[model samples]
Target: MCPTSPSASIFGINTVHRMSLQSALIGFLISRMLPTPLTPQQIIVVQTTAVATGTMPLAAGFVGILPALGLLSEERDGTPPIHLTWLSAVGWSCSVAFFGVFLSPPLRKQVIIEEQLAFPSGTATAQLISVLHKLPPPDTSIRSRRGYLHLDTEDDSAEPTGRSPSSPQPIDTETDADINEREFVQHEGWHALTYSFLASSIMTLIAYFFPILFSIPLFGNYLAKEWLWTFTPSLSYVGQGIIMGFPTAVSMNLGMLVGWAVLSPLSKSQGWAPGAVGDMTNGARGWILWTSLAIMCADSVVSLFPVVYEYFSDLYRAQILRRGDSSSKEDHEVETEDRLVPYTWVTAGLLISIFVGTILVWVVFGNEGIKPWATVLGFILGGMLSVLGVRALGETDLNPVSGLGKISQLFFAWIQPGNVVANIIAGGVAEAGAQQAGDLMQDLKTGHLCKASPRAQFLGQMIGSSVSILVTATAYSLYTRAYPIPGPSFPAPTAYVWLSLARLLRDGQLPEKSGVFMFAFAIVFGLVSASKTYAARRQSPIAKWIPSGVAFAIGFLNTPSFSLARLVGGIMDYVYRTRYARDGNDISLIVVASGFVLGEGVISVVSLVLRTFGVGVISCWGCGHGLCGGCPAV
Candidate 1:
């Protein structure tokens, strides 16, 4: 929300609704810092439910281009006057959410638990949760090592066994001494996380109060001195850098080097620049902004070629090759409380949501558009597209909902040409359905790792979705009335992109206004990126040096502050990897980083709320979001 650049990502909630859970996970750890630490399962239940609750807002809000399209639509008085109705928008969004819920179980079986696609982000979340909650084996030694941070574990799978030095009454068994030892480990873990939280919070507070430390353009005052680079220190981004591995760091920084250090300055000198390379506000909205978009949006579909083919081929083996006898050992093992939602409930929910959605659309639009056949088509497309969406989510952390939605819109527009409302509803279903399903599956993955019940997680998702219906509806009405989207205060750039596409499609051609070179370059780069990604999987030594298109796109458009903060985080993790931890992804580092993310995120949300209520936070003239003067004493 704070990003002033047009090239900024829309917070990526469609496929990975992670920030809230990330925060909640750390919040849970912080709670345990000075109090009784609940079991891992207990913390998981709270985190999943809390995270699940935030997903509806993703569908409701204009995070991606799909939800934001309505901002561009308007009702003009004329014969057969038509406009997108708020009721229809809310109703259809809810329907898509439910559709995701029902479709997720089967997808979970085929893709997640069975095929085991490397949903890296979800896998990382699961690993973090398991590590945080895992009680050390009873027979494990708890000797003081280098410092409180060092766990001194021989293995992640460390367990106690028969030992002559130990007594016959095994220490690994249920005993008072073992229980106390376990408590000590848990307490120490909490202590370390809390200290990290405090340290991160203090640093963040300093930046907010004194902008000299962060968020200022380097080498000059706002413009004309250096490339458009800000020294913004994002606590959450630092945490993100910790999670993504070293190859990712190098790839992303390489992009920043090329775009910022090279191309940006060159563009400005030639007078073909996007803006002042040093200005943080609109400097990033340069010609390269479009170039970055060409890479990101085009590569989203390009990368999906392999994933979509694999997805359908797997289905073919299950249905045609095996005659629909597709079952696995893990499914049977998970029957008790961790199995898929019942077939009847899922079926009923799907039917009801579809029916409700159609009725709501018809009622709101009054037969001006929105056909029943369109609704059915929407259901089919949404379900199919979800496979592509979740697969992209698993393999890469990128969400393809917006790209997939545009494709659906293109298809549906041809089917019912000139019916904007119908196309939007149809496209919205495809986009939102996949978006919700991807989100739920990520939650399910975390639960699976924590040994929590899948059935329980499904129920939690339903509860969260049901609540989101009311919450999202109210939020939409309130936020729109307050600031309005696509406006200066709430510039929904993604929505603008969607609407711009719609307009161009109506004219039956892409914009011919001199971007061919950029497009050609992007397409070629995207292809090369895709090829390199595939080749890298074969253990090619050269693969390590290949610049990831995804990382490059992020770094290419975003200010150096964004990349540098993440770089620092990566450097920090590498430091730990070399000296402190067995791997860069030590549980201790994750715990601390999680604390950093949660502490800052919580405070920012608070500041937003206070500002919303017309209460002055930290503000001053000539200040780029810095606390300038002393606050009025409370």
Candidate 2:
């Protein structure tokens, strides 16, 4: 669930790490596939529908299948220490996906409707939907800002069609190719997005063969002389920044500053951190992983106190204080299904997830490796952290999943110190939960603006997650079976984190005892965060500049240069948005951004598929090197 934490409309989709962008493109292609060329409005509905079913589940599998496979893949005692059927893995993943669907409604209320988080991608999708449908405005104004999302006013009579409910778009048989293309640009702004997709894909293809030649700075080269160690100049990072916007971008950068720019250099100078010899990147990684983990774990606990207290306090006010709202019912009414998915289905899904999850954990990890109570705690944290993840997404469109997952991993470690598999699976659930929730909301936001059927969106989510479980599991299994892992073909980067941790724990290698000081520092930062929460509750203006604890933690998840790229993108977006946002019709820039992102994703997908199937996407004449470490038998 690689939610881009995006904002710059079109480009954000490609910046996302998962297949969400594919859903958008696929939907667009579906329109093309139709005998009659549909307008962008119709295509958006198609896109939203496809995304609901496609993106969520595919990304969600990392949580479900990866953990079981991770444990199964581990060669303990000269063979896999634990055993479980592939069906069990699929079942575990499905159950988690279902839990996501179950949990969405409550979260939608608490985070979206109540808290009014930005949900940048969601907001952009809504705008995009408007453009697609060419909806008429209700004399609306966008109070665009950083942090929170505000739908300044609700046009009670407004629909996705941008027309009164009684009106309908005229059906036309006009079929001039030039007219169609111009109309596509006018309505959906697809042309710019298409061009970007083509350009980036071409560059990606060129980079694949000639890593040295046509070497783009962002994707290929480091700054000056390998200064930052894997300082990738990627469009994805830039797109991410643009999508996340100013508040999130800046806060994340602050975190990056602390991790790489500040801490890494400080640690290196003191000669305290390892990886002193090889590259600067190593120091950055070591410090951030160590310090950020401590900070995030503490922050996770401290940040919750305010939210929980606020929730309860609200309940008390509603009950004892008897507080009441003055807004009219018409102002709040929505055309879509009030409850997107049925409570019955959610209950079933929750039960199944817990039941299957319990069986899977016990079967795979065994009694000694982990306790049942630990697994329960994992699911609980996963559930709770998912809310936090979704809330952050709504506010900043920035996914805090990696940071959240790391915290979950640490929590599991505390519960059962030595079991690496337990840590990984626990982290997986948290990550997956975040993905499912975020994916649903992203789709729903588009659906809401497009006035697509909520029930259809819900159904799409369920079906997509289910299908993805099977597809991801099968494909993963095939790839793993074909390639001896830590080899070409099946890199399984996610698996590496757990495997490495398991090895260290199994061999009794934990972080140094001095690392406890980091915990102390984390506590200080967390308490400060708690203080900020109190100030925010009082509506103090100063709280706005406090820098989000969650967003800061998110910064440590990626490298410094990547964070820098996002900041740059955010700045550019701000510049363009300031000029164009007034019209409410200025979507060409958004379209351009989208094109670039989609191109990157589509080309990457093609390249990945080709690589997996033992084919090279291109050939380099001077250098015989390919991404596959030169051609080998598949």
Candidate 3:
């Protein structure tokens, strides 16, 4: 049987109580299991539990189960056991211990430099602190050469009458202390925990439940046709615009339209129907699989180049400039500042590693047996498309799997119409999963600030996500069993290999409109790329124009209602940010938002549980509606 779901209670009371219980349990278990006292580093290892257990475990479980069930692999009707073994538990425990020990020294050094030294903010550690607690603004004044020179005289005498006239008065310690205390009270401790929990819960709930709501009538049907109309003159839309910074959201929505609605439908109409070109015996599907993998690999390689360049530049600058200086002790002293890894480098490395690992797994495990040349070409195309994908959607701060999935969908649509629908669904699931993981990160950040064990947070996420799996799997199974997609409808990739061959046959013509379209598309793409670069360098007006243009294009292309929903979300986000900014960070709004998110997530879990028991209820409509028929009538 699956693990028992946590007892439902009100946010503050239930959560705090449950956490306290869990913490005690962990402490007790550690004392009984371990032979020695855990070092500070080992203590920190607990944090990994937060990641390991949540979405990661859920994802792993899904991957494991899917292949066994024939939904994902050749194996059929096999069920993996769900028992938690002794060896597995020990491995997890050791991993947590090692992570804490390895991370502590750096973390400790950061705390001292950042907290005690009173250094200026904006460093990685500082940002973490700020997110964890309220921090005073950075000191913006430049240290003048003359001021440094005169510092000795000021220190030598209580009253230095000969000090430079331009020297600014020293800060009043008492007043500064009072201000710092107030800031700390406002940002750190319980307040930070509250905000983190709220933000994470809300984001998670929305990611999980929005798709379900999107399927309901009036709202779902309307948004699927007229996306923009839903958001016209709406405050929520305006708010969303402000919070997401307009450009990113607009671009992402436009991408969805171009990929899903337009390309998908067009592919089907071009004689790319299933079973028309090749039989399963010809190994046609293997070619498409290899093609997709190649694209993913190329994209990963392109993404890594920037990171390598940045690292080398930093190494050169450090070794050649400051330490290499001859003949000046003073200059050497001034140059010997702490080394740091730039945020850009970290971001790039993370993206490249994730995509590369994913592609490797797919290529090695996938059933496809395409040619080496085709794989290489696919990789190059995937990499080229990566740039376009980023511009189209903005940065997700989530997993790159969904982005790659989208690229696959677009490419497959060009090759075979029958694969379009399956690709879209896959993209959606991958994206949604990443979004859920991101929500967990927000929570983990909060937990980090609050001195909560990272391991605990990881465990919490695993527990939470595992709950989702049980619910989602059962619901999906029942729903599909009750109302499977009919014949002639899309077969969801597994049902047909002929779809790919049909696409190849239809597009086999050499001197066709497709080629013409490709040339024109290339030109348009070059113009956009050039424009974006200029905007980045010069902060040109086009920076605003392009995203807006994309948004307008999407408004025309997609259902007005879906666009309307996005606009509504944007507007609400804008207002929330504005209000929070004005109130000087009350933390209450964050809590309220978190409540909404948690409520939504909890409801989803409930729905899933009910479905597993064979109880059916009408799902709620979109964000605008709170409750309909999903909840049992009192």
Candidate of highest lDDT:
1
Model 2 lDDT tens row, 258-310: 76666666666666555642121244344455565556556656655544454
lDDT on C-alpha atoms for all candidate structures: 0.57, 0.53, 0.32
Q: Model 3, 438-549: lDDT tens per residue?
A: 3233333333333445444444444544444444344334433332221111112222212232233334432223344334434454455445434533435565445432
The candidate that wins on TM-score is 1
* TM-score between candidate 2 and the true structure: 0.69
Q: What is the lDDT of residue 407 in candidate 3?
A: 50
lDDT of 3 at 556: 29
TM-score winner between candidates 1 and 2:
1
Question: How well does each candidate superpose onto the true structure, as a TM-score?
Answer: 0.74, 0.69, 0.42
Poorest 10 consecutive residues of model 3 by lDDT? 1-10
Report the error of model 1 at residue 488, Å. Answer: 7.5
lDDT of 1: 0.57
**What's the alpha carbon RMSD for model 2?**
7.7
| Candidate 1 residue lDDT tens string, 369-469 | 56877877887888888888887776555566656777888888888777665666677666778877887777666666556677777777777777777
Cα deviation in Å at residue 242, candidate 3?
8.8
Show the colliding residue pairs in model 1.
119-394, 228-277, 274-286
